[model samples]
Target: MYTPPAFRDDDKDSLIATIRAARLANLVTATADGPLATPLPLFLDETEGEHGVIHGHLAKANPQWRVPAIGDGLAIFMGPDAYVTPAWYATKQETGKVVPTWNYAAVHAYGPVEFFEDADRLLEVVTRLTNLHEGARAAPWAVSDAPPDFIQSQLRGIVGLRMPVVRLEGKRKMSQNRNAADRAGVASGLAASERPSDREVAALIS
Candidate 1:
């Protein structure tokens, strides 16, 4: 999150886009015992608040939901990332001063943490999350597709999570700090890489 001025991303749309594209996130909270974290598939409700609201669930047995968080929780969303070699920098040849760095996009959302167990609300959250992820498939699955009793039993084993976002921070490091020639070199080098993520970084730079 230590973003330099050149790499800071203040655009709201860009921040939300990165968050939406991130299918998984790390939810972190501070507790009396210690810090607790969980990786989950979270969804954003853009209509809920001035910023937005985040919704997700954790296993009923996960201790993270049991502990009381002192204040706000942090949800971390990561986008495409790639390693950048100094060889891709024109400055490396000019002054041999360039070092390796990384190019990536990430967003951090902070909000008050709320845990709930209402069966009806849990069912609604599960249904919406399922539909959001499954909608892109040819044969999308639905919660109602399974036996009612079985689905109900499964829901009993989880707890719902809600966080109304109070702050959003985004960082996009895509060679923006480099000069035009160095940036062009980086783009060319990344575009030629076999790694899909590198090609994605190249596109962002372009």
Candidate 2:
């Protein structure tokens, strides 16, 4: 989150895009006991609130929900990332002054956290989340595919969460601080990497 001016991303669309692209996110909250974090598949309900609302669920056994949060909760979403070797920097060849770095996109959303056990709301949340992830598949599944009693029992085992986003912080460190030549070198190097994630980062270098 310590984004330099050159790497700061204040564009709303860009921030939302990073969040949507992230298949999983980390939810963190400060508590009297300590800090707790859960990796979850969260979705943003863009129609709600000023910034929007985040929706997800946690296992009922997860103590994070039982412990009262002292302040706003944070949800972290990360996009494509790759390690950038100094060898990819033209400055390394020219002046040997460049060091290794990382290129990635990330978003942090902060807001009050609410956990609920309402069966109806839990059912809605699970259904929507399932559709969001399965929409792209050829044989997309649905909550209705399962028996209602079974789904209800499953819902009883988890708690739904909602966080109306009060703030959003985005960072895109894609060689923006580097000179054009160095950036081009980085793009090319990453594009040639066998790692698909590196290639994905290469596409975002501009």
Candidate 3:
């Protein structure tokens, strides 16, 4: 991810938190044809492995699952991000030597990838994913909510994915490189923004 020392985040908990905060992520794998990527809703099992195991599923027709992975796959998780204007830097007024940049948080996990079609395992993955996304809803839905025959038919159309994380890399660029005055300006400016992501980044800065 080319993270500089100042921007690198090595804290395991912080890295996992960023992954959880990202509602969606991209899974990338190298292949003989080229690099293939898929946008997916992946869940992490923090209790497993030194890092954790990632779980998700793909459409049965997805070519990504059919392609043989050359090496470890990379799953990218992105958190809150915001644009930082040069105007948000005190140095812009003091020396006019500032430029625009971005502030954001992200995590990259690498691991061997596995694709499967076992109905029992697929059912478990589907149920867990559904529950995770619906956990906070007043009227939560479940795989069991549907007819067993219907659910079984639906499961036939998809495949499951598992990746036991071998390593994790995280970066949090929240104006920590800036002077105190500039950092304050960035936080305040973002806080005033109407964009929810900007405001989220503002909270991280503070």
On lDDT, the leading prediction is 2
Per residue, candidate 2 scores C-alpha lDDT tens digits across 56-155 of 9999999999999999999999999999999988898899998888999999999999999999999999999999999999999999999999999999
Candidate 3 lDDT for residue 47 = 88
- lDDT for model 1 comes to 0.95
Q: How many pairs of residues collide in model 2?
A: 0
lDDT of 1 by residue, 118-156 (tens): 999999999999999999999999999999999889999
Off by over 4 Å in 3: none
User: Which window of 10 residues has the lowest lDDT sum in candidate 3?
Assistant: 43-52
- Deviating ranges (above 4 Å) for candidate 1: none
Tell me the deviation in Å of residue 74 in model 1: 0.3
RMSD of each: 0.9, 0.6, 0.7
Q: What shift in Å separates residue 62 of candidate 2 from its native position after superposition?
A: 0.3
User: How do the predictions measure up, each by TM-score?
Assistant: 0.97, 0.99, 0.98
lDDT of 2: 0.97
Better of 1 and 2 by lDDT: 2
What would the TM-score be for candidate 3 when compared with the true structure? Answer: 0.98
What local distance difference test score does each model get? 0.95, 0.97, 0.95
Model 2 lDDT-worst window of ten: 85-94
